[model samples]
Each structure stands twice: as C-alpha cells, then as structure tokens.
Target: MNAERFEALAEAFGGDVARWPADEREAAAVLMAARADWARSVLGLAGEVDTALYAYAPPQASVGLADRIAAAGPRPGRGRWMGFLWPAGLGAGLAAACAAGIFVGAHLSAAAVSAEPLEPVTMAVSDQDFDFDLDGEV
Candidate 1:
C-alpha cells in the first residue's frame, strides 16, 4: 500500500487497475484510495505517454527489399564432394616416386649380382687380443 509502489504500477500498467499485477493490484488500489490526488496525477501522465506512443506511425520498408535479400542468399548446387578433389597433385607425384624407386632397386640388385665376390680375409685370434684391462668395475 505504498504510494511509490502505486505510482510505479500505474505508470507501467496504465490507469487501469485490472491490468496491474493480480497480487499487488489490491494493495495499490488501497494506496490510490488513500491518496487519490497523487495517484491520479501519476496515472494521468502515464496515460498521456501511452497515448502518444500508440499514435506513432512506423516507417515502411523500401520496395523490392525482399527480392534483394533473396538474391544475396546462397544458391543450391551439387553436393560438397563435387567442389574439389583432395590432395590434387599428390597422386601423380606418388606414382612418379614409385616408378623411380623400382628402377633404382632393379639396377642396384642386378649390379650386386653381377659384381665380383669379395675375397675372404684370413686372421688368427690369440688370448693376448683379450688381455686389455676393462674400464668398468663389477
């Protein structure tokens, strides 16, 4: 039943008591009855503001606005996969590398088979070769 609460309700909901919040409307009405003059002054100003807002006219959009917006949008086309092939030049490069590897491998293997066998070197091992002092301790 506060005057400030009554003023706020009247301003927001307009001069109609029914339009005010159901729970608060009764208390606000009591305040309005107790201070009719103040409540009327606040509600009168609120009504004036509401009237001016209602009287305003909104501007219309320009002609062909819908057409322009529609035209600017994306057009339907083939699926995403149709756009481009992935790793475009990698296939050709890979084929060329494989061919070069086969050629080199064949050439190396043929040369190895045709080359002269290395002569086996004969050496004598003795106990003196293993007589050095080891650096690590057990």
Candidate 2:
C-alpha cells in the first residue's frame, strides 16, 4: 500500500490494525513495515481522536422520558375514521357521480322529446321476403 492509503486507513479505522478491513490489513502491514516512522505519526494522530471518543460518556435520560414521549404521540381517535372511511368514501363518491350522470341523461332525453316533433316510422318490404299468393281465401 502507498503512504497516502496507509494514512487514510489509520484515520478511518482509528489507528487499530485489527479494526482495518481484512483485505486492507495485509497491504497496511506492508506499508507500515516499509515506512515505520511516517506510519506511526499518522497512527498517533488518529489514536488521540480514538482515545477521546472512547472516553466519552453520554448523559442518561430521566425515568419519565418514555412516558413523556408516548404522551406526545398521536391520540387514538385522531385519523382513526379516515383509515376505515377513505375507500368507502371513494366508492360513495363514485356512486353519486354515476347517479348524477344518469339523472342528467334522462333529463336531456325528456327535454329533446318535448322540444321536437315525433316522426312516423316506415319499413320497405322486399318481394323475396313475402312470396305467398293472395287468392281471396284465408
């Protein structure tokens, strides 16, 4: 490994060769063997940061923290009906729209009938359709 790569690995893995990636450990070892002094300097800097992080202690939460967080959560009744009614409301709205369309169609048909005069319907008969002779007998 190059000096730059060795320094980068030391910084990322907290100067611990064991913490370095398994594939990179061999290359890092080779680099350290070639440049012991330079590698130690980089590792020393990274080790200081690691030591500070390991020494840190976070503040503990109070006993009522969970209860307070739970109290801040959504109430049971909020949006409860929406889960059950969303699809049902969509179906009801579609049904209303269909009913409205049918009502408008019927109203339009009735208006058209009253506003225009009706015409007589006639049909033409072909000779092939009726070939029976009329001999004045039933």
Candidate 3:
C-alpha cells in the first residue's frame, strides 16, 4: 500500500494493524516496513484516538431500565409456539375461510336457481280510492 492508503487504514482501524481487514493487513505491513518513520507517526496519532476511545465510559442507564425492558418483552406461552407457525398458519386459515365461503356461496346460489319463481301481481289506482273535501275539514 502507498503512504496515503496506509495512513487512511491506520485512521480507520485505530492504529492496530491486527484490527484491519485481513486483505489489507499484509499490504499495510509491507508499507510500514518500507516507510517505518512516517508509518509510526501516523500510527502514533491514531493510537492516541484509540486510547481515548478505549478509556471512555458511557453513562449508566437508570435503575430498573433493564427490568422494565425485560418486562415489556414477549411472555412465554401460546404466542411463542405460534410465532414459529405464524406465516404458514395465517395463510392456511385465510385459505380455508375463503374455501368455506366459496362452498357456502355456491350452495346458496344453486338453491336460489332451483327455487320456484314468484308470480307477478298487478294493482290499479282510481279516483274512487280516496275522498277529499276542498274546505280543510276532516
């Protein structure tokens, strides 16, 4: 690797060549051996950053936060077993329901087709069907 690429890798991998990607490690080692002084300077700067990162301590979570998270998690029972079969079982249930609905619909439609047709009735309206007074009296 060239000096620029070696420096980039050192920055990214935090000065530890062992932490670098396997394919890049051998090239980095060759470049480091060829340009020892410059490589050491780059590695030294990167190592300072790595040391600071390693020394960092993140703030602790509030008490019972873990317990609350655990409490909200899925409980052991029917749901756990059902989770394994969820996709397949749900698809099967929907298919069965559709099949049942189709069967019932077909049976009902056939019954309707075989049933007797209703006779038509006729009605006539004439003026004699109602009596009216012009004066607003019942």
Per-prediction TM-score to the true structure, in the order listed: 0.38, 0.42, 0.50
For residues 52-113, could you state the per-residue lDDT of candidate 2 as single tens digits? 99889888898999899998666666585655655578588668889999999999999989
**lDDT for model 2:** 0.83
Clashing pairs in 2: none
Q: What is the C-alpha RMSD of each candidate to the true structure, in Å?
A: 20.4, 15.3, 20.1
Relative to the true structure, candidate 3 reaches a TM of: 0.50
C-alpha lDDT values of all predictions: 0.75, 0.83, 0.84
- lDDT, candidate 1, 21-103, per-residue tens: 89997787788788888888888887887788879989877999989999755556723432232235657766878999999
Two-way lDDT contest, 1 vs 3, winner: 3
Q: Best-fitting candidate, measured by TM-score? A: 3
Clashes per model (N, Cα, C within 3 A): 0, 0, 0
Which rank order by lDDT, best down to worst?
3, 2, 1
Candidate 1: residue pairs that collide: none
Residues forming the 10-long window of minimal summed lDDT in candidate 2: 129-138
- Candidate 3 — which residues are off by over 4 angstroms? 80-138
